[model samples]
Target: EDSIVPAAMYEPLVKAFGDAKNQVSLFKDIVLKLPRDNRATLLLMIDFIILVATNQGNQMDMSGMVTALSSCLLRPPRHLQERISAASNVFAIIMFFATNRGTFFAPEVSSLTQFLPPDDPALHQPYSNDKAEQPQQTQQTLQTLQTQQTQQPQQPQQSQPK
Candidate 1:
């Protein structure tokens, strides 16, 4: 039983992300001292969040995950504009999540998005696309919504008496 995924394996991650929601500064401090290798893993985690949201964009609440990633001190800000173009996929993702949830995380992701010099183009992007979608995914999403609606119980309407 213990050989399976361990609770300890996810505890710190949950804690870090949870804390990031309430106090971004604290989350920043915790990750600030982590070695470069750990920081690289953190980047993977950010990518994972984007991937999940893209795949399950309409099903779950990813605002917190996006917020945590934005809050963390991933990389120094400098190549932000360049990175955006390089990782167009990831760029579209965070943007998708931010777009659906309104401008809640825009200011934070933009303000926190920055990287140091010497890196040709690291990664990042958001917004600017009013219409960004793949035909297959859009079709699948619509079908799923239709199925869900049919499965739910319809509410009864009340009548008013004159």
Candidate 2:
């Protein structure tokens, strides 16, 4: 069944997904029909996400990375979302290496970043509380200095006694 499924069924789905005209709707259908335990489903999801991310500004709309991330998050079952999130991290690391080598790993890093949530502490660390508050603290100090300057009365020079 596995052999037949990939060769016969999955190939057609992949081909349909590759088509620009109806790829999004077709991918949705394929996702709905995919067997829950099938690894191909995961692969197909990744491929479709990459396709949409890369094709933005051409046949597809790139918009931002958040759209792709949101689509994956909206998929049924928390397990699948977690799997895709892990896959995204792996892809990010791989692409970073590829980019440093002056090679293109994929054309969708920006979109991927957009899809990732800010609260994902594993993705990006938050500033320390003290560090985060430093800007506001500095602004307040500047305001205090300005107020002190305004409140101080300038002393009048005494008239010279003849």
Candidate 3:
């Protein structure tokens, strides 16, 4: 039952963003309100940013992309940054999308790199290491959290000592 909720939430999001729209601000508003713990919401926000950055048509407004990317970069949750850093595929996709359209803001890209700790162990690891490892790490972490969520039954709270 718990597993189904995530899949369910993602399906509609993918459908809604199937096409790019100028209503980027509205999308940003909705994303801001979504629960921080939900991976689907974060993915949806990423997808939305990608879509805006890649849109070839005039309907694709870069302003929205800039706004969304700025918001995400300002103080992204650790999990979301981990997800982005892990997904090399997302970078390729974003580049491909941006190339045909125009170009993504360089500052935004640079800002994202700051998401990682300056001395992250991954930075010291060999560059030849599998690029796919980060995504797998993210998935494993998310799964562990989800499993914990499902297994831990809620307990009624006792009044605390004043």
Candidate 4:
């Protein structure tokens, strides 16, 4: 039961990861925004997909895995017309995540932060499409700082008296 994603979160998740060029960053954002249990469940699901696709590449590639899991993963748009129009986009989003799992799920950066309280000043307001770059930018800045620290010149230590 812990592995099951709640049906209620499906719609909002789809909307949060709405179509755009930078789906991997959006994928990372959605994963981090999830409640603790849900976040664990989703990460497990993605790992499973990657495992299956990798082990059975001849039998099931990323697109094939996405097709197999689409019903389980995606919540269709409510209106009939909307569902018809949105099906491909829904698949595309999932496909993009699957194909670029390395970028979105990089081991060094993939850990989810503990959930923040609703009123926590640090929690970002719900992300908008335009603000999708924020997470990626933050990540880049972190990497740059880490690189600078590692590459900083070590000052020569004066000889210590015995």
Candidate 5:
């Protein structure tokens, strides 16, 4: 439990996707460098997400899970411009990882390369509900959130008890 997932762990992979000709290999190289426990923790979380998404596909598919979980699992770098620039790549990597399921990391097993996103980093965009099963419902929920945030008055803070 590190509260902040290290940007060092993610940014290199993001850069690798953009710069490396063999992005999968470069991604594996970056990942295998992590400490054994860190690697296990990362993979285990991804696996759990995969399992939940698989059983709940009607409600939340793999792409949805990746969209929701990536921010919780990896923190991007500190620079404002770089952070904005890297966001799509970060989403791409998470999508790639969830789709491939760490297949590149295991030499013994055959890689399941299905559902792989495009290698071109420029094509990666933040997940939109247009891709979701219920786009209208999701849009309504999002609109409701925006409306509440704008229309609701802030609660007054109470003094702390002695």
Candidate 6:
């Protein structure tokens, strides 16, 4: 309920507790100091703010929420940086689309990158289906490994001498 419920509630109460104005003091003061697993839960709370503020037509300024998220992603214990960056990317896309319904895209665009952050370089690049899944190296490597596994001939197992 943290995400979905708060997503609904923040529409009316943003003036009081909006992260933009509060600068997400609660998250900085309490959540960031918590352990990794705990931070995950609290990070999600901000996502609720993003999703709600956008989808609810609440017209709230998201700068504080964005700043809080960037800190969460860019702060230390660098181990979690990648995961945080990824989650923040998801949060950015959701917020962008929810706020701007269609300046350059509609659901019919069917291209996921159309919803990327305003500053993403990929936004300037031309999109094509071939470039959609560019991280093919890993999948190709896995396929090669599977083919090798299937093609190799197996030798009869030798019983160990007692």
In order, candidate lDDTs are 0.42, 0.43, 0.43, 0.60, 0.62, 0.45
lDDT of 3: 0.43
lDDT (Cα, 0-100) at 10 in candidate 2: 42
Q: Which candidate has the highest TM-score of all?
A: 5
Candidate 1 per-residue C-alpha lDDT over 1-162 given as tens digits, one digit per residue, 9 for 90 to 100: 121112232333234444636534543444444443453344445555655667754553455556445433222233332442313423333444344322222323322232212352433434233435656678999999999999999988878877
lDDT of 2 by residue, 16-108 (tens): 535869754654554445443342334334445556657746554433333444334233234333433434533442232222211321244
Lowest-scoring 10 consecutive residues by lDDT in candidate 1?
A: 1-10
Model 3 regions more than 4 Å off: 1-37, 59-67, 72-162
Pairs with backbone N, CA or C atoms under 3 Å apart (clashes), candidate 5: none
Stretches of candidate 5 exceeding 4 Å from the true structure: 1-5, 56-58, 80-87, 105-162
Model 5 C-alpha lDDT per residue in residues 1-162, reported as the tens digit of each score: 451235566556656777757787777777667654455556666776677788943588887777787767666666633753435755677677777864644534212221223583423544333556577788899999999999989989999999
lDDT of 3 by residue, 1-162 (tens): 132113233333333334366334433433334443332333444546666656787464654554445433233234444433423323432333334322222233222232234585643554334677888998999999999999999999999999
| Estimated TM-score for each candidate | 0.26, 0.23, 0.21, 0.48, 0.55, 0.22
Q: What's model 2's lDDT at 18?
A: 55
Task: Give candidate 4's TM-score.
Answer: 0.48
Judging by lDDT against the true structure, name the best candidate.
Answer: 5
lDDT of 2: 0.43
Cα lDDT over the full model 5 = 0.62
Rank by TM-score (best first): 5, 4, 1, 2, 6, 3
